[model samples]
Target: MRAYNETWIENKNVVSQAERWHRRSLLTDDQLTAVRKAYPVGFQTMNGFLEIGLFIFTIIATGGVFLLFVELLSIDDSSIFGLYCLLFGIGLAILNNVLIRRRQFYRNGVDNALVMATTALMVGGFNSQFLDDGSLWQWCLVALPLLAAVVWYYGDTLITFIALAVLYTCLFDLTLEASFGRTLLPFVGMVVSGLLMQATRMIRQRAYYDDAVSLTQWVALAMLLVSVNYYVVRETNWLLIRSTLRRSGVMSPPEIDLPWLFWLLTVGLPIGYLWQGFVRKNRMLIILGVLGVAAAVATIRYYVGILPLNVHLTLCGLFLIGIAVGGIRYLRSSRYGFTDVPDEDSPDEFLISSDVITAAQVAAGTSGHDQHDNVKFGGGKFGGGGAGGGYN
Candidate 1:
């Protein structure tokens, strides 16, 4: 009876150990999956919190600035205080971003969102001309370039550069010499936009390309320079065309006869078309480019003496349709190429095939460049492979 009891106890001990091992294996698998799911969610939540916090702070800061201006409306000395609020607000913004970054999150999403929000706020504030007390929003203007430099230094985004360019252009509107020949702003903006596009192509980073999303920014910059040219040229006789348009056939803006704004529209549309054409390098793009240049010339002729709006609009419509056709052709041409084994002496360093590397040990005896490279990493061939050849 004692021997039977001893045998039963031995059997129970073995079964308990097996059960414990089985539970541990199952728990380990569950924990792994839970960790994988939680990591991404945790990062996203952190990013969302920072974005919301920064946006709220900017609004509150702007409000405080507005109130300060209202309070100091009577004194010439109040400009100094308004400047103080602007500087302090900008400082707080920079500090907030630094703090938000210290908390862990998906780094790319956090950086992109914060930079985008900040730039959008700057542009909106510029558009609103936030400080209307005849101060030219001077403090905001001065801080903008500094903000741009910081963006360039550490932001690692294409939008950051584009925002910098726009800020540079905005200086024109803020300047005392806007009435003079200060078309430098828009010209520089266009150049910067093109350079950024090239940088995007070479770097293959999406963040940089996002900055070129400013269609209005491009147009506004162009108009500033064009307006300068119109004033210098002084072709006021074009106003007679408005009467002709009214009498003959088409409805147009009441101020359409003015050469200043109309000439800008004339130059802008063609420049946009030509610029896209040259950048893209398609045959159709080249043709559209010619048409755009021609249209601009035609518009100028109509305004000056000879042609008319209806004819101009017709040619413009045809040019636009051609632009769409060219775009589709360009898209179709950009297909991905096949992955191939790279030439040994070629400049390219190819990524290895995962499948070949996985089963590499079994076929280690087979002489291949890949096996030689694998062995270098201490992944030895299966046969007589020491620590250097066998799986570590």
Candidate 2:
């Protein structure tokens, strides 16, 4: 189902676990090296800065070549231009596949850039060539399947986000055109987002798909909140209604139906998310919950301006600081598998200092038996550790 090598993916996961163990001081330097040598990952990757630089470079290079081709051919017609774009997109897609299969590029900038360009070109070309009088929703309908296919093949997080966005746009536009659409749109969005959230949650966890699935789930959660958010519902409804009224030559202020229901959702959804976050101990949910709360506050301030913006912001900041300080203090002792203390075993910590690991490895090699004797063995989240086969 995936384009990348399965064995390499498994090896990459093993290496990740080994790195975590080494960071936690549960794996000896020698053991870490042994694990690395035993399970090798062939995927070509880059550091964050390099990846971004290469991504930009790839886009620029490809765009330049495309423009040069268009200039040389002197293609001016929309149909011809669309045909060229389709050809270019197909070429890029093939190149992407070649890079992945032959060079084992995974999340590397070249592959990422190619996939993105391919998607954009294909969608643009299709719209230009085939949909002369089509609506925006119709265009989005065309894009949704292409984006979904790209996501399934590449499992790119950004592509997944684009796919979700297209899906949302399609739904929104379609629903807005229906009978009683203004009244039903928000609820429809809520229902679809809720179903999407559940679907993502039930997907079988795999290394290749994990990031995409997580991103989809997060987007679904956000969409669900936005669907019921008072400001969003009211503003969007007003805008649509205003447009319709302008078309009909009727200038009247729009009023939302069931303002009370929207208000309840605006206040209640955030609290629900916050409670669910704490209960599930999900960091993404907690962060979204905090944002939801901010949105709710903003909505209130938008409608009813009792306090000044600066005063409201200052109070919110102070309240947040107080909560953070109190929560940290409360979680200092580590209750219910949660703590204020940072995990030494975290993957982020592992990436921070390769030199430290090298120095420790050198010291271990020099001290030999003494270092082995001094090594601590204990129960860890990974397993009872001494690096022997704990990672295995």
Candidate 3:
């Protein structure tokens, strides 16, 4: 009985020692390192490349715009044909698209392509040459609507805005050039295009507000301002007004000019951009503000140039006053434009609060603020205090 009890105690001691050794082996340096290395990581996404590629494309597009302008300026009275140039530009646009696709990932290729294509179409308009007897300007009246149609089909606001710009330019040419008939086509076309752009934006329900809308509105506003200045200058002198307005169509039974149509560009147009930037939180709204101020200054400068120093200063002061008041109003009402991302599981929708303005945000500026500081905006919020990922 004593020998049996001693044997059982010895067996128990052996089992305990083996278990201790096994645990110690698992805690060894080699085993610890292997376990650390086994954690799963997800880092194969190409988002970095996508961003870099987009920047490159933007630069290329800018260069292309410069080239188009240079070609337009080179045209002379003797040389009438610009169709060749337009065709050449279209070809280059196509080739550029192909190269961009090959060099970059296909994330937003369609969007990029549509923008380039729209640019090509507008450049084509600039190259138009009228071949009628003694008339060197070709009719570009047809291209505006066609281009807008394409933009609408693609559901691309950037390109649609370009189409709108082209239409607005056409309207300017019509009113200033005296081709009132020509203006009708683009006027109706742009109103329709603008509606289409608004509709697409609504239907698609974009997750974020686009800055391009602001830019386009600025372009339109500038055009309207220039037209206004031209009209005001013409009103003071009938002969000059007659020459400027005679380019398109005759009014009042082929003699009297219709002046009311001219104010539509100035009085009604800037309001669009004002709404976008001040109310919609569009960054492009800043552009509208700049252009609006410039237009006002240019108009005042035209009138001020003929006046004495005191009058000029007073005119300038008045202009500044109007601008300041508008700026204050716009700033006070503007919403912080930011994208709100919601969690997949949570019922609560997360949005960027207006209080957490960053340097980037200050730089972007919400409304009525100078573009000196950076104010960061647009990001999702969460319950956790720290950010997490699938892997460290």
Best by lDDT, which number? 2
Give the per-residue lDDT of model 3 (tens digit) for 1-392.
11012222233233323323433473564543333234211111123245457646765775586567657766544333355455544655565555534543222343355356545644554445433332222234555655654544333445655566666555545554564543343344445446545654555332122233433443443433443433332443344345645665543122224434544444444455566666765554444444544454444344335776677667767987997787566656443643233221112211232222222223322111111111111111110101111010
- Model 2, range 1-392, lDDT digits (tens) per residue? 56667666666667666766876799997898787678766665445566789899999999999999999999999999999999999999988888888976777788899999999999999888899889989999988888998998888878998898899889889888888998999998999899998888788877677677777777787778778987778778878778778888867546588889989988898789889988998766776677777777777776786987778778877998999999999999999878988774434353556446435434433111111100111112112111111111
Q: What would the TM-scores of all predictions be? A: 0.36, 0.84, 0.37
Clashes of 2: 0
Candidate 1: residue 205 lDDT (0-100): 36
Candidate 1: give the clashing pairs.
Answer: 158-208, 379-389, 380-389, 380-390
| Model 3 weakest 10-residue run by lDDT | 383-392
Clashes of 3: 26
The TM-score obtained by model 2 is: 0.84
The candidate that achieves the highest TM-score relative to the unseen native structure: 2
Candidate 3 all-Cα RMSD: 21.5
Off by over 4 Å in 1: 1-91, 102-141, 153-298, 301-315, 318-392
Steric clashes per prediction: 4, 0, 26
lDDT of 1 by residue, 157-193 (tens): 3454455445545554454345532333334434544
